[model samples]
Target: MNRVPVSSSNLSSVGYDESNQVLEIEFHGGRVYQYFDVPQRIHQELMNAGSHGKYFHRNIEDKYRYDQVK
Candidate 1:
């Protein structure tokens, strides 16, 4: 199980569980997403985005490598 670090910046709020390779993201609109099979580098890129919150929603959430929260 990989152990990815979680960023604490207010620009983004996301959690990753290495055991299952699941990524949990909380967007600015209060929308959430759980991404599966996400690579560590991609996760870091997502967190490092200038607009982390918005990028997650616009690019990743329900589009790229992630699905909407159940």
Candidate 2:
């Protein structure tokens, strides 16, 4: 997946695989995680949110199955 760098204190970049419904997020601390079964709409909202980290915590964190990619 190709991740685009974002301006977030916690998140470094984000990527999505629509075909497989996977959402990938890389943190500033170099931790990378991929959330399974994520809808594209959620991905878009995260990208557009005022605070990506806050949005993740409120809406995405612990809400989906995930794996630590790195």
* Most accurate candidate by lDDT: 2
TM-score of model 2 relative to the true fold?
0.97
lDDT of 1 by residue, 1-70 (tens): 2233335343336777766667787645556667888766667777687766565656656654667773
lDDT of each: 0.63, 0.96
- lDDT digits (tens) for residues 1-70 of candidate 2: 9999988999999999999999999999899999999999999999999999999999899999999989
Please give the TM-score that candidate 1 achieves against the real structure: 0.55
* Span of ten consecutive residues with least summed lDDT in model 1: 1-10
Candidate 2: give the clashing pairs: none
- Compute the lDDT of residue 47 as modeled in candidate 1: 69
lDDT assessment of candidate 2: 0.96
The true-versus-predicted C-alpha distance at residue 33 of model 2, in Å, is: 0.3
- Backbone collisions counted per model: 0, 0
Q: Cα deviation in Å at residue 52, candidate 1?
A: 0.7
